[model samples]
Target: MAPEPYTIPITVRGYETDSQGHLNQAVYLQYAEHARWTYLQHGGIRQSDLLDKGIGPVALEVTVRYLRELRAGDETEVDCRFVWGEGKTFRIEQQIRRTDGTVAAEVTGVGGLLDLQARKLVADPREYFRALADDPAVFGL
Candidate 1:
């Protein structure tokens, strides 16, 4: 069975809306990025830890699908799940849902851990994450 996704709540702010009063397209990516970082933090993995280990996370590709529109003051929950497979990369799947249970958007990404010195993707990123995380199970390790 798949593990539960990490989730964080967010409120749409007026400044983040477009002239049409809907959430700006670019902001959705920000929301997704926020969720990903929060997930890492929740697992006790901090940005400094990764950097100290001479590595950093890199997003190779991202795809966003807009569904229902979001407006200022709307409360939403963003959930992030990491799917690990064989090799140097992993998949991140996220969903932004309004309080009413409507899905506003879905973001999918391909990411990897890069060796800062080598400037190349790591052979097994999970090893690095497992070494740094307080509870590797949070990432389904």
Candidate 2:
């Protein structure tokens, strides 16, 4: 279930910085999440489609490992890869890298397919993702 690697080049905006002159930890998650969304959109999962489907994907767990400090003006990119999961979950592993190819941080988020109304995990993950994976209108499927 590996989607193509997505590179998100970012300019460290002032709002994303802290008084410490570096990006705040929360901003890292935000950046990674954006990268994930960008990958999904590129793959063909549009927000309108999701809304029409009456389903939602929510993160059930995450692991964030910071390897180095990034300061303002550092050109960086986040590479994202989607992986298989157990049950109704999908796992995405991502690495935020510097222009020199140094790993700045690693993040993994486990997202569960949910029934929008009941707010419960879907019973069949394969069928659900397959629908998305199959509909070229919905995915690179």
On TM-score, the candidate that comes out on top is 1
All candidates: CA RMSD (Å): 0.6, 2.6
Cα lDDT, model 2, residue 34: 90
- Each candidate structure's TM-score, on Cα atoms with residue i matched to residue i, is 0.98, 0.87
lDDT of 2 by residue, 50-72 (tens): 66788877888989999988888
lDDT of each: 0.96, 0.77
Backbone-clash count (model 2)? 1
Deviating ranges (above 4 Å) for candidate 2: 1-3, 133-141
Q: Could you give candidate 1's per-residue lDDT for residues 2-42 as a string of tens digits?
A: 67999999999999999999999999999999999999999
Angstrom error of the Cα, residue 114, model 2: value is: 1.2
Worst 10 residues of 2 by lDDT: 132-141
